[model samples]
Target: MRDGIPRFVPEDNYGKSFGYQWNLHRLTQLDSYVGLPVSRDRLLRESGWTTDELEGREVLECGSGAGRFTEVLCQTGAAVTSFDISNAVEANATSNGRFAGLRLLQASIYDLPLMDESFDYLVCLGVIQHTPDVERAFKTIFRYLRPGGKFCIDVYAAIVAYPHLRQLLRPVTKRIPPGKLYGVVQSITPRLLPVSTRLSAVPWVGDYLTRLVPVANHRHLGLSDTETVRTWSVLDTFDWLSPQFERPQPRRRLERWCRDLRLSEFEIERIRGLYVVRGTK
Candidate 1:
């Protein structure tokens, strides 16, 4: 393997923005780095899989950006095969390479180098919406799951008739090179965050007004430290704007997809503005 990590896709592709951002903010979202269980909590809640259940099982993690969840998965004593469509695999390896039972690869979700019905569990979080064809990507990954294997995924939720400020700016922001776009986000976040924070406190208008500001302010997340809040704001704001594809799907549509796949015991529910789907094949 090149550089001690398996490479499937070319070093540059549509996920370049993700690769750049994750490498730059390598440790930003990791629970180990943040001294919080944010990543672990989300993984557990969304997957409904306890660490005890995962121990000694096999888990295939797609779109493992910077290994935020990879770190938690590796700690579970599971054999974790984590891959990304971007060079974020490098960042993931840097963060979690030392963990036993962890394998890092740079690969596309559409064309994975794995056997069908091979994995016991598959998880794709905050990823499918970024792919060119969400359904195809889902089916491709699902093919890798063994019979009775469990899966968990989350996608951005569609809001009917709502004018999302991020979507309005993405056309321009996504076209800009990720390195330059990151700088733009950094410069604007400090200025707009204060205003957004103030507006977010207002009753009804606050949510609307806060949307007008492009920066992602995480004041409500209980990050007590001001510097940490600022760092998260800048990182998340860049993440929000720099993606090449950011498709949000309706909850019903996601449920329909699960039905089409004939995934048993499947449920699609909203969690923190994302539609999280969990089921077994």
Candidate 2:
């Protein structure tokens, strides 16, 4: 660590877009806003783990942007090692710092600081797809799990058409400065939100129409508050638009990774354009 702060080679940090976006919406996705811990629910559903399964477990949560899911993991009474490749971990630290079962680190998935076979469970959500190399990232994360240790990962589905538009727009949008791109998304999100909501209601063709738009439509994500929706709309849209790399991977590819690594009892499924993979080492 340089000057008492972790210093990564500039090339390894590919999450400046995420850092910019999450700092503003640090607590927006947490359960405190609504009576439901939706983030927690998503984790449990994706990993096929019950509440009791997480208690006292040692979990390594990679790409823990803004600590949304970090809070959920900590709430499970588990010792969580959360890391992100951006300054967003600062927001994570501020919000979840008081928890005794938490350890926060700012590190890239490709080059994490932890030792091999050091964790009981490894979770990398909303992350692998955004990495420069999905397969390599998967291999690297797999090295952290102990023999028979379990892991759950979620990434954008490679076959999904929604991401095609983002890929089309990213060449130009990603070139724009983070602040400027954020400004562009912030101003247009409110207007596009209503358009997205209206078009999403058009019967048979609504979902496709909504997907055609470049903005993220959270209408069907089970989110309920207006302000929360609006905030998430902007943040998630910027998320889709601003990433340097956003390659969605297919279930087959994930299964291939598991097979190549000789992982046992692995399961891969797609849910709402996201591929969820759970496996045992």
Candidate 3:
């Protein structure tokens, strides 16, 4: 098992509970990236690729935090295997149980316990950078995908963003607890106002009421609803804590990597602040 919080999936033998709020309603709201202009339900529409592209194909998704997209992939006739490092996703498994073809496995990207060349389509989004090593993780995932299979992914690009600016605030921000720190950050950041943030936005109220708060300006810009706000509050804080910008692989660089791995036909779509790289093995 990978070294991390006690909630690490591989170490959790029971899988009875993951002690996190990860329901379908909550997950669909936390995100708006990947397949831009398209919601998670509109995956094929936005990416210009559909599950019909690989009818009845075996699929795999790494870092299936809440299996929101996993549900969509399975609905499209793909056999989907979703994996994550946290037992916290046990709730995700339960929530997604309606999809019989969907499978939830507890594992990490660096040490995926799967038979080589077992999948025809692979997806690892919003992950990789948080791992011990990115290259190693990519190589490991590549081994599981069969030749001619496609891999679609979205990750933080190296481009500079004010969110990264949160790092500078971390010095003072870190002094407080994670929950409280997130709240303070949320208040100053106006984007978090309309919707209520769960973990990150909760503690700020206490601090604000008691006058222990620090700063507030960042707005809750993207997330529209309360559930979306909470999920974003928890996740964005996690991103701020472990921001890893890994992207913009020159087409040649990515092409060579794909070639070495027997993956072909590389294409990249640049979204507002990130990149969605799609290629075939």
Q: Rate the local accuracy (lDDT) of all candidates.
A: 0.88, 0.83, 0.55
List residue ranges in candidate 1 displaced over 4 A: 160-162
Local accuracy of candidate 3 as per-residue lDDT tens digits, 70-138: 767766777887887756456566556677787776666666668999998888776665555656666
Model 2 residue 264 lDDT score: 76
Clashing residue pairs in candidate 1 are none
Error of 1 at 63 (Å): 0.4
What order do candidates take by TM-score, descending? 1, 2, 3
Backbone clashes in model 1 = 0
Pairwise lDDT winner, candidates 1 and 3 = 1
Better of 1 and 2 by TM-score: 1
Candidate 3 is scored at a TM of 0.67
Span of 10 residues, lowest total lDDT, candidate 1: 158-167
Model 1 per-residue lDDT at 152: 95
